[model samples]
Target: MKHLTGPAYVDIRERALRFVRDELIPLEREARLGPEDPWPRDLLRRIWKRSNELGLLKAALPVELGGPGLSTVELCLLKAEIAETGALFALHVLGELSGPPRVGSLMNFASAYQIERFFKPVMEGDKGICFAMTEPHSGSDAASIKTSAVRDGDDLVINGRKHFISGSPFADIAIVICVTDPEAGPKGMTAVLVELDAPGVRMDETYVPMSGQHIDADIVFENVRVPAANVIGGFGNGLRLGMARVNLNRLLHTSWMIGAARKVYRMSLDYARTRMQSGGPIARFQAIQHMLADMATTLFACESMMLHAAMKADQGEDLRMEASACKVFISERCFEIADKAVQIHGNVGVTKNHPVELTFRQLRLARILTGTSEIQRNAVAREILQA
Candidate 1:
């Protein structure tokens, strides 16, 4: 649900914009460096701690839970601001502040002891958690994951390898999705809380993709033993619990995409208005104007879809089809906008020095990372044809 009103939201948006403009944007140069650079880590850690002190760390939580708990509408506005800054800032400010993908499920489903031992530390920023679901062979088909968790006396022994696990290298704990009963199909899948430091848990490789600062990992669990009580929402409820939490995850992705799209549009517009061309600025050309206009129009459409879906979610309305539609439309359109932005800047935009270059890489990855556009379309069609 929405926690902030009209003026309050405006204030929050303005504050976020200022933070990105005045504070985060200044670090864009250093943020673009590869993971081998030590400065980015130190800087991100400093900003993360400062963000907590400024009370900007709990944007992912709902209002009832004591965070500003911005509504989906509010998140759209705020994320756009953060996304425009750069990937490092987006990862540190929005990604870190929002907590992990499984935070909501953990809050809703974890037992008292689980809450105190695991959930609380994550919420308080004392630690981080990663959602380990994607496997080497499985991406969108989550139910096909082959990781097995078998009961062994009072403990559950988990064995398998998780690939493309975001935040794994930095996470202290992980919510592992595994097959508990091969005969039960989807119902056989179960969610277990695993401590990364536990014996037999190993993160051997870190994958640094488009954004140099963000790290994904290949995690291996070789007969890793987790307490029987660590099962979230009980055994055999993994898919059900995941479906409940992923709706918000999809919405958050839209917010991040739209935000970055807006940034590129603004940057392109500014460049067109000032860059000298044949007798005048490029902005004077009808072609440039049309491109700018199209970018703005597309961004507005994405925002409308995102806001509408978020509003419906806040009102407790089921938006499965609408959410899928938003995911597909926004992701594709955002990439288009970023591409147009690079064209507008010509050679300079293609350089590693430009923020647009980094933005282009990140937006391109967004299309495939979160349920791919193809998978989202399939989901929309299934819902439509369902009896």
Candidate 2:
């Protein structure tokens, strides 16, 4: 039961598919070249402008804002399809200039002035924002963050070091999570908007992950003063609000993981049919058939779970457990799918000529980012055991 139907949803999906297949997939080679490779920023900007004219860029935003206001299910479906081209394509379609896909959190929690100053500029593509929560020491244990934001007369003087923050290097602003009261533990945390150009804010360097597909940055704040009004959700409410943002992001990750898995499966299936074996194509063999079967089954099950979670979310259900379960299941299964794709393709899978090499590397990070498999399992167990 999807919340959207009729020609409108179908049109959105079809247009998105054509865009990914025709516009984005052609750039796979350039995009996967290396971490130091420059992004197709100008090309992407042109496509973005065209997409906005066609209403594609506005699909994730609310309807009242002159956008399509897609439901969770609709957004997931479109995202999964867009993801077939790759992460960069999916992100571009999701309005990369607006920062992350779930920057809706800012719309909900940011002050009117902050929205006018930051959010609007980001959405309008004049600026970029990065989430600065994962610290040098605080990755999964966000409660363990040591960054401090000392209250002053009309501002908070912040001092901290954040690394592995995506988009930080190119961002003009950052939503930084800091400890406003060390004594209050997680409850003492707060989210503050900081202008990267402000004094004492520095982008130390951009670090590449093992995949070497994207770059994250190390940022240091030394006595950076952010007006007190920039605080989101008020002081002592950061953890709760941050978790809320995580749930939405985890859901998007789950859907895109499925997309990447599906792409791997397709590559494997094509190879199986063409790669010669004993007498004919390997796809005719029972073993190859069984492998494809397993891949399809895994993809179907993961997609089902993703849709279930999305629907639950649309119905206003608390998806703490469902979101974690989806993240854990999809991450592991997507990796397995990619592994199977590699095994099926043998030597070709590892070659840069095919997309699997890049897919394999990116899928591996799916387990670690958003939340680790171990962390998500603990979260699910904790929720189930709670009184």
For model 1, the stretches where C-alpha displacement exceeds 4 angstroms are: 1-46, 94-101, 211-213
RMSD of each: 2.9, 2.7
lDDT of 2 at 13: 79
Question: How do the residues 247-359 of candidate 1 rate in per-residue lDDT, one tens digit apiece?
Answer: 66787778889878888899999999899988889999898898899999998899888888888887888777888888999999999999999989999889884778878
Instruction: State candidate 2's TM-score.
Output: 0.90
- Taken over the whole model, the C-alpha lDDT of each candidate is 0.78, 0.79
TM-score versus the correct structure, for each prediction: 0.90, 0.90
Residue 89 displacement (Å), model 2: 3.1
Clashes per candidate, residues 3 or more apart or on different chains: 1, 0
Candidate 1 global TM-score: 0.90
User: Clashes in candidate 2: how many?
Assistant: 0
- Model 2 residue 152 lDDT? 95
Q: Candidate 2, residues 356-383: lDDT per residue as tens digits? A: 8778888899899888999999989998
